[model samples]
Target: MKALTASSLTGLALLALTGCGESVSNRLMAPTDGPSATKAGTPIMRGLTSSAGVVPTAYDGNTSGDGSSSCSALGFGSTGTKVDGAYSQKVGGYQFTVSGSEKQYLAFAPSGTPTSTILAVIVKGGDAYDVYNYRNNPRTSDAGLTSPYNHGGNIPTISHYVVCYGPYTPPIFTKTLVGVMKEGATIGSMEDDLSWRDHPDLVIIPWGRTRWLDWQLSYTLPPGVTGIITENATTVCGSLGTFRLQCTFNENPATYPIYTWSGLSGQGAVLVMNDLGGGGAGSCGDHDYTNTATLALSNGTTLTASKTITVRVVCPTTP
Candidate 1:
């Protein structure tokens, strides 16, 4: 995949190849200096439809405070696993998809005001859990479990992530974005390029979060084809999507760019929505499918948005 900047995009030059954004690159991932205080207007979703049928339904609660704020996992999906108990006053959890084998620092910060102490856990499986404080990790309660791991230690990527604020009070508990930071790197990075590069002439982040939202994408498929497979041109046919709104990370990887989404469980980050079916055929005859999603953000609000996604399945030409 060729890593190009946004300014370099010509009349379909960058799109013709697998062009990624600043936060993404080949073997090289991007990170920022922690979270930036972004102005929250209707999340600027241009090009395609993603937010239900709305561009970005304004925050149901106050846009100022953390109320109804979304608990964003940059590369995660729309759904999440809700949890409650000892550490969690109000928990919002989602399984994370590790992109590669590189050890990363899991960063968490409140939306309205950044806080140091947030109750976060890496649930491996069963009753076993790796608990910690995001910034001052190393809160492993189990003697056998070595968590809050060293930057060079073996970390579990294909695991569940649950986040809540410590001292858990009303609201502002789950209002955070769980971001992955490679060791020595700063903070803040965009999710992988979710745009399906098969077609150079399309728009929309389609589905994803940049600034935790604002995105675009497009793809072509043979009519009626769906789920994990490739095309006649050997293009990987199905989209790897989220099982829940958690980013898929591959703990054990043999290649770079190991973090990807898919429809197949345990494959990549997400399970591609099954019904993104092609219409009949022909580029001019693109069918419209509205991709709608309602999310219960960690900040404690439910958001719903809708937009039309064009599904194009071109009829093959006789050679």
Candidate 2:
């Protein structure tokens, strides 16, 4: 008689179970790390998929039927109970805890009606505990295509819990600075010409997620100087979970001055002013100017920041 080796014994066992089809032993015999294995040396169990060969659905932000039936389908107890607010439950082998002020329960029917619906408990601006998909009903396999709770076409009438938080905080601007230029006297020059051309543009700094809904600027020029020529006002605003706001000196040229004060350096916001060709040579003297900037936010909030700068052009005295 021939001795039966371990390999031969394993082969015989496999043949015997061949008639039983894909059993637990068959999965156990599969390779440790592959599509079939959850990890190294860990094969997935056949029980994760439904015996009826029905897949689950995914969760989308659509709700139906008061969310009770959907929640119940996920095995969260009865339909008539007040399942809203903070609560914890184990669904599809995962422990889920949701806490918040506003709770919303919704039924998710990714495949539309007549198909199984998935219960979704959403908690807004709150935290969820141990929320994850089941290993068996992976989002990969076609059999696990549908959601975990809506398996085998069996509507479990479960309940999902959700919490909703309040609105987000409004945006704000801070840490603003303005730039100025001072001119020196030149040899043999009659007078200094103080034009905005010699100085850099104005700078404005904003902080937080600020969205500028409206912006206006007013300026006071020196005596004999009629008006000022400024570039078009340009602003950038968008939503980054919250609102974000930014504005530049000029839309076309886009030139901003760099300045450092009190050991901090940054490219402060700027306002471009064209040279009006005023301020005669001997008039090379310091001129004070005031600029007022008004900004409005999408949240109906207004902000005001002002900066005063001096522009000077001096002349030399010849003997």
Predicted structure with the largest lDDT when compared to the true one:
2
Residues 1-319, model 1: lDDT tens digits: 9886666754254243223221111212112322221224211111111112211111111111121122333222222333322122223322222233332223322344233233333333121223322222212111121112111213323233344333322211111111211212245543422343443233222222211222221222221212232111111121212211212222224432222322322112221221122222132234443433333222323333344434444434459
Give candidate 2 misplaced runs (Cα > 4 Å): 1-149, 152-158, 164-171, 186-319
lDDT of 1 at 88: 21
Predicted candidate 2 versus true structure: per-residue lDDT over 60-137, tens digit per residue: 223333444433444433332223333454333223443223222122111211111112233211111111222222
Q: After superposition on all CA atoms, how large is the RMSD of candidate 1?
A: 27.0
Give the alpha-carbon lDDT of every model: 0.26, 0.29
The clash count for each model shown is 45, 28
The global Cα lDDT (0 to 1) of model 2 is: 0.29
Instruction: Highest TM-score: give the candidate number.
Output: 2
TM-score of 2: 0.21
Q: Give the TM-score of candidate 1.
A: 0.18
Flag regions of model 1 displaced more than 4 Å. Answer: 1-271, 279-284, 298-300, 305-308, 315-319
| Candidate 1 global lDDT | 0.26
